[model samples]
Target: AFFITYTYPRTAVSFSEAMDWTPGQLSGNFLLPSILEPGQTYNVRARLETLEDPTQETDTDWGVITIPEAPPEVPPAADIRNLDFGAAGGTYEIGER
Candidate 1:
């Protein structure tokens, strides 16, 4: 039996699942839950049990993983070269030029 656990840093969010192997099963897969956020870091670890005994289990050190962050957005730019400030002080909104 194999037990895997993942935890988000600095919060109470976590997800865990288990897998049991038969006599000939060699591969398994676990789908990530939707509660996890993107670009956030999380700690992960796994424990393997032998003969369903708690005292005969092995655990790995916690590992770090981070999801990719979204790309930045760029605003539109104007190409006006010459501008007149008129007289002294005045409030100007966008596209007032």
Candidate 2:
């Protein structure tokens, strides 16, 4: 006597708490590195752990995010020097030249 076997692939996720975040958008803020350096590539991915089967969890496609460099800090502007303005009706007109 002989026996036959059949196998099928899983098509759905089991009961578990998971998150589905929209691409190119931020749902909320999460803990980030204390200091994030600029001009660097970081690996980003979303995961969904299965309650029934830990090994059969789901993971989003891996993503590469490049950090941007911080803009240069500008110094405060200097104050205007002596601005001589004659009296209301004096010789030197305020709006002249």
Candidate 3:
């Protein structure tokens, strides 16, 4: 059997106090009173502290928390036509492309 563990940093320096995750089956998803500001970045970290037996304790893993970017100013439907199909189709042959 296994259990979920959720943890994060105690302080907020570059980011606001609010942060969250998306929909799925896992750990660390919570709603906040405020939304993240535009053009900002945040970093959060967590670890799993586990006990294999009554006498032994261990930290299984650690991970950085991700806060997804905000939606673009234009809606999907409105910007669908403006998409450049030529650039998206991988037709450009260059050093990087």
Candidate 4:
């Protein structure tokens, strides 16, 4: 008899329901929710059951799922400060200094 099962890692609120599988082996890509924020974590779970006889069938296994944090955010160039000496110099006066 052959059986198939899937498992996911712990993650944040964002998670993927659609999964895929290969021949004999189990594998799939998860589409995470867009609402999920970057750098956040989540948990996931999955299970498999056999369809043999009621008395013979059993819950094969169970595991936890995890969703990785999103990529880092890049700041705009305009928001960055220009530290070049030639660009500008200190504006402090003798009294201010």
TM-score of each: 0.32, 0.31, 0.29, 0.30
Number of the candidate with higher TM-score, 1 or 4:
1
RMSD for all candidates, in order, please.
13.4, 19.4, 16.0, 14.1
Q: What's the distance in Å from true for residue 55, model 1?
A: 1.5
Alpha-carbon error at 12 in model 1, in Å?
A: 28
Q: What's the lDDT for all of these models?
A: 0.46, 0.47, 0.43, 0.45
Mind giving the per-residue lDDT tens digits that candidate 4 earns over 1-97? Answer: 5533334452223213453332233445576554556655444455443334435433343243344456345565773366544545778556753
Candidates in descending TM-score order: 1, 2, 4, 3
lDDT of 3: 0.43
Please provide the root mean square deviation of candidate 4 (C-alpha atoms, Å): 14.1
Decoy 3 TM-score against native: 0.29
List the candidate 2 regions with Cα displacement exceeding 4 Å.
1-28, 64-97
List of clashing residue pairs for candidate 1: none
- Which residues of candidate 3, in runs, are more than 4 Å off? 1-28, 33-35, 51-63, 69-97
Worst 10 residues of 3 by lDDT: 12-21
TM-score top scorer? 1
Model 2 lDDT tens row, 21-95: 444432333444534445654555554456577687555565523334443445668665866666565586459
Whose TM-score is higher: candidate 2's or candidate 3's?
2
Instruction: Put down candidate 1 lDDT per residue, 1-97, tens digits, no spaces.
Output: 5544654333222223454333321233444655566566555554444544557654444542233443344455865675555666789566855
